[model samples]
Target: MQDEEQDRPLLGRTVGITAERKAAEIGAALPRRGAEVRDGAAMHTVPVPQDGELRTATESVLAAPVDRVVVVTGAGFRGWLEAAEHHGLADRLVEQLTGAELLARGAKARGAIRGAGLVESWTSPAEESAEVLERLLAEDLRGQRIAVQLHGEPMRAFRDALAEAGAEVLPVRVYRWTDPEDLSALDALIDEIIAGRIDALPLTSAPAAANLLGRAERTGRGEQLRGALREGVFLACVGPVTAAPIAAAELPYAMPDRARTGALVRLVADRFARD
Candidate 1:
């Protein structure tokens, strides 16, 4: 089977990748399947400096042990830890958090917490902030102090829910999302999709999907581009979070059973086979 599969099923097919951190790996996955890959890194992650919002949140958490702590993303947690380490407070921060009732949003967060030599009291099965809030609300959190490490964008709804339940929430944004320095490449990709020069586009995050559509709208090609995607261009997302904006736009898309990059590639390959 390995010998037969070497034929590169993606040959003559074109797919787009919108991830920055894992662009090389994801880009490589497509060509192996015989598909032409387009790099569509929509945004980059920028860590907040030591004297930024994260530092303030760190000071507050270290001042006193929080009643409950929520970790939203593994990468964000690692970034926070690195920042704390730089300030020579990594050990203290870890010690303080270990005393709190640690909660994780998903497997990734749980892994990060465990990697830091701490244990989580529980983790949200849904792997999202809304679900995390749900699990936390199930407890008697009135007047409890909760510290949240936001991955990138602020999860305002999750924070608001905690406040409504009378929990003192310290929401810390450890990083920010900035648009790609050059979107000319993205614009060119858009032109290819609209012109039927491309076959599929896989989006790993919601922001990239939203920004792609936003760009099309700004260039007055929204309808034309949307039409192409809905009709022929295969729009594949890693999972629901990435698919949410695409769904909201009423565009048709495909997602694998698991939200992994390998699964996404297999999904596209299988999709082409079925058609």
Candidate 2:
């Protein structure tokens, strides 16, 4: 599986991934490694957002004069606005979004928010929720009202920290990462793994890994197959949340000092070359 062509170069190499649009950046990076890209939407095609909660949360934000609004994910950015648009609240959402202190958790998220004509007051240190919250805590949130947008799950610590700092925190759950409704995509992901077609894997989230593993299990070759795939393949994770599922599965994996995609790709490129 060592294609020295892609050893340090990473070209002529293919990493089976399911990240939707983010995959473009990931794919573009591989060419620097001399890698050609292969698509596997089952791997992690980004989830389409369902914004029932976002509507309620945005209304809450408009209701109160909030001090800051933290948006967590790029998907949330598009989804929130789309949700607002659907309900004839696009203009209102934009106005409200701009009114408060706007914080973004990742580069893509920040980019999306800024593209919408709102500047981020605070951009998180890294993609991790805790890191975003840590940066927020450094600010004087005391006696201030803040609204946080949740991607999938509640960030207990982030919310608790705001409360501890004497600030009122409102949670807006904009979207959810759902279990794959279409098993065909799941099946193909398993096939790629079993075939050892994935040279290197970059995991952005635990759910993506779990989804692949689940697909493997359904095919009745989960253990026997993943063992072989794990051999020739390098598994890289962006951060703790992304790495946890691999550790839980007791699989060998690597995580970078920083969770950004740049860091993740660099770690993958450098380590594979070194090994």
Query: What lDDT does candidate 2 reach at residue 227?
Result: 94
lDDT of 1 by residue, 1-275 (tens): 54444556666788877777768878888887788887766777788878777888899888866999999889999889999999888999999898899889789899999999999999877566666777888888898889989866576667888999999899878988777777888888888889998888888777778888888898999999899999988889887767878999999998887766778888888776554
lDDT of 2 by residue, 115-153 (tens): 888888877776677677777788788888888877664
Best by lDDT: 1
On a 0 to 1 TM-score scale, where does candidate 2 land against the true structure?
0.73
Those runs of model 1 whose alpha carbons end farther than 4 Å from true positions after fitting are 1-9, 106-108, 123-134
TM-score of candidate 1 against the unseen true structure: 0.85
The 0-to-1 C-alpha lDDT of every candidate, in the order given, reads 0.83, 0.73
TM-score of each: 0.85, 0.73
Q: State in Å the error of residue 170, model 2.
A: 3.3
